[model samples]
Target: MSSKHKYLNDWAAYFDETGKVTRFAFRFFREAVKPPYEFRELLKQCYVIGYQSLFLVGLTGFIMGLVFDLQSRPTMIEFGAESFMPGMIGISIVREIGPVITALICAGKIGSSIGAELGSMKVTEQIDAMEVSGTNPFKYLVVTRIMAATLMLPILTIAADGIGLFGSYLIESYKGDVTFKLYINKVINILSFGDMVPSIIKTFFFGFAIGLIGCYKGYNSEKGTAGVGAAANVAVVIASLLVFVLDLIAVLISDIFYEL
Candidate 1:
């Protein structure tokens, strides 16, 4: 193909993929509410995606809180704003850092797992078998997984924030001789309903995007074993990128809401 022709073809391909994903999303919405909810599978997936993520998420949150607090201490002390550190950390963690970090972690962990699993099923023709055997594979598989992710992520974000704050408190206590009660008071006094609600609302979008992208890549996977790996890798990349995009949108919306 000529260079211009090839470039046009690539653009066409991108648009086509976007359309297919949109249709896939619409189908999910349609099927999600119809009937015969896969409660069992959803519970299983919640366990798989949510419960299993706690250790890694908690560990990461702790390490992040420790490192960020420690690094920020010298700066705060230099500015003679050391007393403000607890509330500052609280605001940063709860409002921005916690949800974004937790979502990114979920994007990597949950997205790749879903993609690889469904891709393997596709490659092995198991999904086809389920289809032929009179089961709604999309409902049983895709809807359940998506709903599970959507439900689990907010909880996970909350967990990461609380644990991260605790980690921050530990460092503050050690370095600045701050009491737990005072740190807690500072954080509580600084935070409000507005700060939390938007952070939480965005997480649902994050989870939805992650689950949707994972399923889309896997469900459409081709070329056998290689496709499975590619699906997993692509799912992680896209989900993580989408998290940042969603976070940006969320910030804009929050700013507008505050302005109103």
Candidate 2:
């Protein structure tokens, strides 16, 4: 195939994969709402997906804040807006960067892990065996993962925002000679519900994308052990890319709403 043709083919394949994942996500939600809920499996997934990744998320959040503050200070100072640093940094972090970064980290950690785990189960015929024994593997496996991700991501984002703010405060104190109380007060004053809500809302979709794609890739895996690795790799890539796409949409929507 020509290079242009290969590019078009790749794009088409990408869209095809996206459509399949969306359909599977909708079906998973429909099945998940019915009876025979897998509460135990859901709890386990939450533990693995949420609590287990807290340390990594926290570390990243802290660094994100510190580096953002360090990087942004010179620009703000050059513009004679040094005093506005806290609010500007806070808005940038909470409004977009914080949630998106946290989601990407979760995608790398939880998405890949779920993919590998489910792919392994598929490879071992455990998923198939569950079906033969009259169990709904999709419900127990896919539903729980999607639900856990949908629920836990908002909580994780909240934690990340807080940690990021703290990181910013520390940097501001060290470099700009800003006091903690004043910095925090500026952050609070600048942060309306408009800044917080849209960012938090987008994370739910990010979580859903991560969980659904990861589970779908693993659940429908092929080629045995190699397929398991492939599923995990693909899950992280798709989930991370989707987080950025959704974040852009969320920003546009938030702007529309704010104007109204």
Candidate 3:
């Protein structure tokens, strides 16, 4: 095709894809509120998606805190602002790093997992069989997973923030001789309710985006096994990108609110 034609085709494809995704999201809302809730499956998904993900997310947060403190300490020490470390780390972790990092981790782990699983079921005709068996496959399979993710991610983000703070404290205690009591005091004193609320709100959006993207991609998967892998790969990429997008929007909204 000519360059002009190719460009137009690309834009057309993009718009078409966007429309499909929008419709899929609308369907989720429609089905989500209908009767015959999948409480048992939702609980199972929460346990699998949330409880199972804790160790990995916690470990990542711990490592992040240690490394962040280690890297930032020298700069603070040079500036004769070593005492501000706890407040700085606390604010950064609670306001930004904890939520973003935790969501990114889940995008890699949970996003791909949901995609691969649903894609496999699609290719294997398991989802079709469920429909044939008079089951609401979309409700049982998609809604539960998405709802579980929406519920669990905020809780996970809070957990990550706490663990990250603890890890930062360990580093501070060793290097700066800062005690836990003093660190906690500085953190509490410096941080306001505002610092935390934005992060908490953003995590819910992140979780929703992750689950929705994963399920959308997986549900529409075609071409059998190869498509399943593609769905999984695309879900991770899109979910990670959406996390950044959502985080940016959260920051912008917070700034607007702060100014008002």
Please provide, for model 3 over 115-159, each residue's C-alpha lDDT reduced to its tens digit, 9 standing for 90 to 100.
999999999999999999999999999999999999999999999
User: Residue-wise lDDT of candidate 2 within 116-198, one digit each (tens)?
Assistant: 99999999999999999999999999999999999999989989989999999999999888899999999999999989888
Residues 115-211, model 1: lDDT tens digits:
9999999999999999999999999999999899999999999999999999999999999999999999999999999999999999999999999
Model 3 scores a TM of 0.99
lDDT of all predictions: 0.95, 0.92, 0.96
Ordered from best to worst lDDT, the candidate numbers read 3, 1, 2
Q: RMSD to native for every prediction?
A: 0.9, 1.9, 0.6
Model 1: per-residue Cα lDDT at residue 20? 93
Ranking by TM-score: 3, 1, 2
By TM-score, the best candidate is 3
Tell me which of candidates 2 and 3 scores higher on lDDT: 3
Against the true structure, whose lDDT is highest? 3
> Per-candidate TM vs. native?
0.98, 0.94, 0.99
Instruction: List candidate 1 segments past 4 Å from native.
Output: none
Candidate 2: segments with Cα more than 4 A from true spot: 1-16
